[model samples]
Target: MARMPLAERRRQLTEAAIRAMTRDGVSRTTTRSIAAEAGVSLSVFHYCFDSKQALLESVLTMITDHYIAVVKEAIRPRATLRETVRAGFQAYWDHVAARPAEHMLTYDLTQYALREPGFEHLARRQYELYCETYAQLLEQLGRQTGFELLVPVPVLARYLAAMTDGVTLNFLVLGDADAAAGILDMVTDHVAGLIRER
Candidate 1:
């Protein structure tokens, strides 16, 4: 392969690290494994990241970015708030279904971050990013639908994030896609109810 820019190289390494972690588990993954997965030399890995923790942090950020883009693309302005909310949730479910390994890796990374002393902040920031992304989406939906939210957007966003985390964990553990989706639909309904008709 041709030489890549520093930013592109970093992205490549981050993706490779995620693939390694997904396949080998966080405890088994190492800088050498990530470098081999990326088809780069060990020196390249060191040049791109300060350490394994830094690379994992990049992986977390990448997952967050991917999820936000998926949800944003899934949600569009619709005639009714209910339809808009359902579409967004369905789109997210589809994304998770298509990339179960990547999604599972995210959860694993979260646990790893929490257990590792220096990385606890990454776990906290990951949830914060989730909340902020949802809050922005909810605020925009409210404005577009011309429906006042029963609760503050930020509060609703935090609730949605926490609820989804639980639902996702259960689904991952039980391998029950249908049940997980049903719960998401219920969440959509609840969110729709929060918006009064104009």
Candidate 2:
């Protein structure tokens, strides 16, 4: 057997944790289960993460990073701000549709983190990352389109994050793609309406 590089090993453990949480729910998932899922020993799991809470934090970061990449790739400069914003929203909902399991796991972990003592910071940091990432994206879009948002970039970013969370959660619970698409279109239109051409 060969030793995995440090980064690779960490990624493996994180992925395993995601699977365990998705399969067993966050409350039931354990470090031992995650290690088993990763095909690593308990000692290796301990070496990688001090506690399950630490591992959940890493999972939150990984999930957020993935979402940021997806949105960034989906959105691009377009002829009009409306087109750009609509395209971005469409791309995002498409991603949620494709990976419902991952999204569900994220929501589950969020609840888990919020209820657990000393772990609430992970939930706070997760939303902060979302807000920060969206703020940067909104700034870039404004630069590209010469449009100004009705609200400050940070406020709009937080609003968009909250909107996305609501839409995704609704879709997850309802399992209605058509309804989700309609809601997404409505939300995108409202968001696009917020930007004035400068």
Candidate 3:
């Protein structure tokens, strides 16, 4: 393989680990498997990441980033804040529908992290990352639309994070697109109500 920067290689390996874990599960996926999935050798994998914990952290971050990027792109200000938020949720739903396995893998990763010794922090960090992502999105929306949230940024962010996690889990378990859309609509209205227009 051609030479690459350490950061790039680590990202490549992390993505590979995601795919491998999604396919074979976190418990089953080994460093050898991740290396093979990334088309790198075992030594290369170790060079990039010292342990599987690091890889798991990278994978969780990567997963969170995938949907957050979509939501950010879709969250541009529309005619109304409600419409803009709806667009963002729609974008997220579209992503989940298209990549169900990847989303499912996130929950699996969470369970695995929680059960694994000394890895509980990873699961905690995962939720923290979710809330942080939501906070940034809320901040971005505020900037774009010049609206104030009745709730503090941190509180609203955690609320959004919890609601989203529940909705995603509900959709994954039930596979009811219509119900999911309704839940999204209810959430959109609730979230919009929290905003104070400038």
Candidate 4:
């Protein structure tokens, strides 16, 4: 219908794939359906992606990118490290509250990747991305705020990633926003305690 760059087309297809997977499921969603969701021909989907693994990778990355962008924006230097950290965590929680389907799709995609033959690496890649995102965010915050962390960045990053993953999953399972917020506050305080003014 309209001329678009390959990168843009791939992004479009990736978003469409997310919707298709969230609605139908990773195992049930077909490339043909993704093409239909994106209003593109199957050939266009093929042109953008070589295989299901590639599409799955794109979908996972897109989902992570979505919240990372929000958290990065929310994490900009604040009056205090606790405030900044809380803002970032709150931003992510808001996204989960608003788009539970998308968040749930991420968990589903991970399980699908892990269980499917020849796609276990996608699940690993998903967790790696999570850890990497936390590490990058920690580095960026440190640079911006000039705070020293008692915990090493790598260790802290993994811990934060695992903690947030569990919290999100807990909220998803319980559907309790209040409990999620309280847990987030506790974790935020714990994390803020890990940092000291340089």
Winning model by lDDT:
4
Model 1 residue 198 distance off true place after TM-score fit, in angstroms: 6.5
Instruction: Work out the TM-score per prediction.
Output: 0.93, 0.94, 0.97, 0.97
> What are the per-model numbers of colliding residue pairs?
0, 0, 0, 0
Instruction: Please state the error at residue 42 of candidate 1 in Å.
Output: 1.5
Cα lDDT listed for each candidate: 0.86, 0.86, 0.93, 0.94
RMSD of each: 1.6, 1.4, 0.9, 0.9
The sequence of per-residue lDDT tens digits that candidate 1 reaches over residues 94-164 is 87888889889988888888998888887888899889989988877777777788888889999999988
User: What is the overall TM-score of model 2 with all chains considered together?
Assistant: 0.94
Q: Quote model 4's TM-score.
A: 0.97
Candidate 4 regions with alpha-carbon error over 4 angstroms = none
Alpha-carbon shift of residue 80 in model 2 (angstroms): 2.5
lDDT of 3 by residue, 1-198 (tens): 899999999999998988999899999999999999999999999998988999999999888898999999999989888999999999999999999989999999899999999999999999999999999999999999999899999998998889888989999999999999999999999999999988
